[model samples]
Target: MAEVPIVVHPAIEQGGRAVVVRNEVAGLAHCDREVVEFLRRVGLPLSDDILDDPVWVEWRGGRAHDYEAA
Candidate 1:
């Protein structure tokens, strides 16, 4: 499959990451579930294990599914 164009931006000071779909701000996500929810809102398909799909999700400033604070 091609890249999903879904970007889970770096977590802010509050440990919440911004979910962006196609350059649009879907919403703020605090966990992996929220990221899935945001992707659904933007009309994206599931990949069985989306959070671990590097081609489906672009994670920055953090590891995949690591939105929690340090």
Candidate 2:
């Protein structure tokens, strides 16, 4: 079996690292919007305004990947 590629976006801070890591397997199995909605349904707070920002997305992705803080 081939290893699924992990999609991640790095944070915008100086010296920041990957803040979000999306598992390709899961992402392929489920839609990204659905996943986000699921998180919201599960009481995971998310702000639409924040989502609208590319930097926040990067920061979120990086944080998920346990990247070092900038």
Best by TM-score: 1
List model 2 lDDT by residue over 1-70, tens digit each: 4432233344444433331223422221122354355445445456655444454343244344343434
Where's the lowest-lDDT run of ten residues in candidate 2? 21-30
Per-residue CA lDDT of model 1 for 1-70, tens digit only, reads 6766888888887888998888889998998888888888878887668778777778888777787655
Error of 2 at 59 (Å): 13
What C-alpha lDDT does candidate 2 achieve relative to the native structure? 0.39
Give the Å shift of residue 56 in candidate 2. 11
Clashing pairs in 2: 18-62, 19-61, 19-62, 19-63, 20-61, 20-62
Per lDDT, the best of the predicted structures is: 1
Clashes (N, CA, C under 3 Å) per candidate: 0, 6
For model 1, the stretches where C-alpha displacement exceeds 4 angstroms are 1-4
TM-score of each: 0.82, 0.26
